[model samples]
Target: VLRLYHAKNVYYRIMRQNVLLLERKPEIPPSKRAHTGKVAVGESNQRWCFDGFEFSCDNGEKLRVTFTLDCCDREAIDWAASTGGYDNSTVQDVMLRSVEKRFGDRLPDTPVQWLTDNGSAYTAHETRKFARELNLEPCTTAVSSPQSNGMAERFVKTMKEYYIAFMPKPEVRTALRNLAAAFTHHNENHPHS
Candidate 1:
């Protein structure tokens, strides 16, 4: 028994050494951690956060999902899914729909700060123009830091846990339909903690 324990310890020590040797250090130094800035605190409709998440269908087709959330109430303002890929157009469509649904035809008297990551779509010239036209102040999170937009990130995680995880893997169309219904229920009925 003593010999067996010694052999096991030696094996584990060698494996630990190998893992340490194989580990690659991060490009950014520990002291240079990404800063996400302060969380927004205001009335409903004043600040909104948005982000994108991706999942794969059973057939291996990728689906991109974008979601916007009201920071005040923690309500999901709007969301969109595209198999074709989320681009500047998709971002515009989602933002426009959200604004129209919440504020109707007329633009808001005060500019709404729409917070998002430094994604290509959010940073695009066309998207910036559209936001300006609709009285939206595009607020971007610090580069490489998603925690700055914690509300949107939490919503995405909740969505996957409550809806997407239980979905039938083989049916993309059905999953999408279910997702729409789930989103509505989540936004309208689900209470935030």
Candidate 2:
């Protein structure tokens, strides 16, 4: 229609002007951003990462799991599993449970880095605000770069290879029960070397 009316250039100019009106993301400071290949920490609670994964049951139902891990000790601090899709609320629950497990109902005296991928749940405004409220500094991995959260990525791989691959997947309820045991076993018996 623009070309037919000899207004193609006008349309282009209008689009160019309107482009600047699009929403822009605020700049995240360097210290609050997750750097690639920098997932390690010298001590527990200094940095923690969380990620989600999903697998199918024998009945073809999908079970999604989200987990929090300490960067220093490589411990699975807390985790949640569900047949439902992952969302901000699920991530928030894991964050609260992890904080409670580590600090015993008290928020961390220092802000701990909460590293995660740029998932909607992790990057949600509410989630980031909640993290700050809990004394956590939220940091997201670089876009399209999972290696920036390598520790959590490796943990997910380990869970899939060592635990999930061998476990019976009769149903979601049974799988959740087994996954809990797997997390416990990983924390207690798995070597962190």
Candidate 3:
């Protein structure tokens, strides 16, 4: 048995010669926006992304804002704010309604797809049931890989940054209004295209 094993010994070797190991994925790494690979954004309008954010209120309460983004043109196709939907079912409901309003024409036939992180809300039963009911396909990213849905992540980051830095953080209603105003400005004048 020892003699036979000795005869079959072969050391492991690198596979590709053109793309060297040292040349792959640089040491400093690119930003999440740069690292994001091609999604079939131009193939169809069915692809979507989702993320949630918390807005600080004056009364020590928080309002949760959830948004759905279309991968193409990188626009916020749907968004909802709630004082109660800190869970998956509520989040899914708002998202579904947004999609339904915009593309209700497709209804049962359109192959809608959504991408998100492994948030508990993303895995809720109501969300699962709704996706099946609407014939939507759901894809989740790796635990640490937020870049898979980097567009959505980027939007959320922008919202938090601008909303806090520019808008006057006042009472609940004023803050909400400011946020809405900011989003409108972002959508209309930012020229992200």
Q: Which runs in model 3 stand beyond 4 Å of their true positions?
A: 1-40, 105-108
Reference-based TM-score of each model: 0.78, 0.82, 0.71
Worst 10 residues of 3 by lDDT: 10-19
Candidate 2, which ten residues in sequence have the lowest lDDT sum?
28-37
Against the reference, the lDDT scores of all candidates come to 0.81, 0.89, 0.70
lDDT by residue for model 1 (4-72), tens: 999999988898988854566768743232233655556888888889998877788777899788888
Residue-wise lDDT of candidate 3 within 7-119, one digit each (tens)?
54421123234343354564664444322444448844667778888877766667788887777766676677777756776667767776676677566467667777778
Q: Give the TM-score of candidate 2.
A: 0.82
Q: In every candidate, how many clashes are there?
A: 0, 0, 0
Which parts of model 1 are misplaced by more than 4 Å?
1-36
Model 3 residue 94 lDDT? 65
- Candidate 2 residue 175 C-alpha distance from true site, Å: 0.7
